[model samples]
Target: MRIALIGQPNCGKSTLFNQVAGYKAETGNFTGTTVTFTESSVRVGGETIEVVDLPGTYTLAGTNPAEREASRYLLSEDVDLIINVLDASHVAQGLELTIELLAMKAPVIVAMNMMDEAARIGIKIDGPALQEKLGVPVMPLVASRGRGVKPLFLAALRMGKKKNPDTSNYLKIKENDRMARHRLAGELEREFVKRGDRRVSKRDRLDDFLLHPFWGYIGLIVILYTFFQIVYGLGVLIETPLLAFLETITSQAATYLGEGKLFTEIVIGALQGVIAGLGIVLPYLVPFLLGLGLLEDIGYMSRVAFLMDALMHRIGLHGKAIVPFILGYGCNVPAVMSTRTLDDPKERFVAAALATLVPCAAILSVVFGLVAFYLGPLIALILYLLNIFIIALVGRVLTAMIPEDTPGLILEIPPYRIPTPRTVVQKAWFRIKEFLVEAWPLLIAGSAILALANYFHAADFFNTLFRPITWTLGLPSATGVPLIFGIFRKELSLVMLGQALGSMSFDTVFTSVQMITFTVFVMFYIPCLATLGALRRELGTKDMFSITGLTVVIAMITALLARGVAMIFF
Candidate 1:
């Protein structure tokens, strides 16, 4: 039997699915369409069943892609049973969707999630009473804590076992009966819900500060600054000792190998790649991802979108663009993939292009390792601010050129709560793991290839080929190989630069102007191959190429401009 999980956005549907299915899930494409749903298998009552977590939709009538996907799946008769996860705190609003789901001619078990939050707001739902009224099983759950999840799915499996189960007995309302259904939902809510004395809810109390126009922006800036300080400071504390240990091992290996042999170069390259991947990148990446995951788990991310709405509109996009923009800082691949959440094609395209330009953690490692260490954190922070300006400028141009009647932000501002440690750690680990898996092999391979080229006296061939652009940016022709390798993985450029120059102390080989120019070039250059693939998947090949061509031009132009300014000034 096939089971479907459906719910409104921010309704804990995903949390419930993850708890029931663990980490074993895949994105399944819809029949003959690009739309995708999460597919997983779960064992209930010693029988394995196919379970699909459908996209979150408030109603079957919604015209959005996610809603359309859910609506189409329900109409396809593919699902034998449905677990309609609902927010217990907002039952009256949630019941509207429940009423529509009931008319779908499938057996449904309502999983009333977030019961603890609801009770805190003085709501007491009589589950059995709701079950009787709806003619379907109602299970109370707190999905975050895994409370009642197993029993909930077990109840769903029992409901699925019945032959041609009837759900049409519910109110018999048409799907288009929006107002009537809402009124009916309110009546049902009154019947099943008992309200105690109203008290100031935590969400409301927190929103007073987080949602304030003046203080909210202040809070956001301060949070971001603190995030950077924590990540950078922790990176300093960890990277020094860690790199020192790795450097010692590499020095011993160098001593053993006794220099200029071809095989020796390969061994050194391999060791340096391993050192750069584990020793340099992991320190910042772990803390940065953990912090991002914490913010997302606590629901501050949505508030960020809400706060940025006005500024986003100025760029001809909505607040929703903030998600991919911020996510791009961690890694551009997922950031580009996340553009699928935007409803408009133009918005998605524009957002994806802009997101690709954001300096990800890989690039952050470069800035922290090379620029911040050689110059100062203040200058490094200035480069970040300049990058933001560039993104805004590019975004504004894209918005103007591809003008559309884009809708404003209609995001759900979920309640602020303490982040679950398990969820945060899992999320952070997943992102960090992606970095290690994708970048390490490429790093090792690229490092060996470059090392071999140097050993074979062919390194100067690439230098001559890229000399025109390299000279224009006031960087040595030798920096060309690292810039090219950056397309494989951004951080690889920094690691390879050390190998290419035979020194990790960048200050010895590069002037301040050349260092800044190279950083700018890397910052705006073509995205890594993984990000390119994600772009092809999210946007099409045509847009991907366009983004690639555009960034190449942007990076070159920006680098030349930086070089010129540096020559004119200091």
Candidate 2:
């Protein structure tokens, strides 16, 4: 039997899935983690049942890809039961989605989740009363704590065995009739909800400082700065040892090659490429993924989205754009995919395009190497700030150019909690495993291809071919090679850059202005292969080409502009 878990953002659907499936899935307080549907299996009464957890969405009627996906799957996919998880404290908001699900005439068992949070907030729910009114079974649950989950599952199993319930009364009403629905909802609330004395809310204290218009922005800056600081510190601590180890292996391989041309090509070209690129990247990726997983599992990311919503709206993006930007710090493919939550096409396009401008893991790795080795921490911070400035600038410009009616941001801010170690490790392992499976093969293949290019001098040929454009941007001719390779994979840019420069320390070879120009060109150059694929899927070929063409032109112009300004000032 197949069961689907559906709910609005932050309603504990993912948590419920994890409990029932007896495995870990990425559950975040934010809307983005569950953007993609995930499937798992559980044994009930000796029968294996498959459960699919769809992305948390607001309303099925919206254009948001996540919402659309949820709606489509629920409507079309044949399933034994629908587990509609709702937030007990925010039933009024969550009921909107439940109503839509009920309209589908499917058998649904409502799991009123987060009952503990509701009780803590002095909001009580009479589940049986609610069930009677909605004409569906309702089970109150604290999914995270594993309370009331078994009963919820039992109810789902019972409902699944029955025929689809009558739901004609649950059809979406016209806008004019919404007032009547609201009145009905209010009546239900009064009958089923009990109020209790309030204790001091933990969130209010944190939000007072973190969500203040002025201090919130300041806090965000500090948090981001600290994040980079941690990345640098962790990268340095681990990378030095790893690099030494890889160098030892490379030296041993060279000895085995024994100076023969073919052996040297394999050792210095193919082997060196993998070791240098993957080795350097792993240290940074490990720490970064771990930090991000912790932040996500602990529910801190939603607070970030909540705090940034006001500023994000100013840029014609919704608050949820924060996820893509944050994910962009890891990689742009997932960042672009996360835009499924934004309901407007124009907003999605702008968010996806601007998200590409957010420096990903490869860029962050480069920054760690360059800043720590040559420019120091202060300059590193400046480069990071430069990235944010460029993203915001692009967002503002695109906002003005696009039509005036951008989608307003309405996000659920999940409460903060300590992340479980098991949950954190599981989430991190999932990401790292995904990276290894999906990205490592590409990395390895790209490395081998680059090795062949270098062996036959194809890279040099391309470098020569693009020299004029390189000169126009005030970058060295050799940079053209890496920029071209950047389209295949972004990390390859850093690899080729390191190879062309023959050292991570480039201050001796290029002036600071030249270094900054090179970095800027690299930063804004073509999107990586994975991201390009996503763009093709999301925007289609014509629009993808337009975006790709536009990015390349903008990168070139921006590089030249930076160079010209540097020449005049310095």
Best by TM-score: 1
What TM-score should be assigned to candidate 2?
0.82
The stretch of ten residues in a row with the least summed lDDT in candidate 2 is: 25-34
lDDT per residue (tens digit) for residues 1-570 in model 1: 899999998898877777767565666667655577777788988999888888889999998877887898898857899889999988988898988888877888889999998887788999998888888888999999999988987888888888978666555664448999989899998898987777677777788888898998999999887887887788779988998899899888988998888888999987877886675356776877788789888899889999999999887789878878877876686678668888888999999999999998789889988889988998799889989988889989888898788868888888887777766766666556555665566666766776687788787788888888888787877888888877865766788899778888899998888888899899999998768867877778899999999899989988888778767755
Q: Estimate each model's TM-score.
A: 0.85, 0.82
Cα lDDT tens digits, model 2, 104-209, are 7577788888888888788878887788778778887888888997777776676677675555544344552445555656666778888676665877788788
- Each candidate: how many clashes? 0, 0
Clashing pairs in 1: none
Query: Which ranges in model 2 have alpha carbons more than 4 Å from their true place?
Result: 22-35, 60-63, 133-135, 162-180, 197-200, 240-282, 296-299, 313-315, 364-387, 418-440, 474-476, 486-513, 530-544, 568-570
Model 2: lDDT of residue 286: 68
Model 1 lowest lDDT segment of ten = 167-176
What is the C-alpha local distance difference test score of candidate 1? 0.83
Superposing every Cα of model 2 onto the true structure, what RMSD results? 4.7
Model 2, 30: alpha-carbon shift in Å?
20
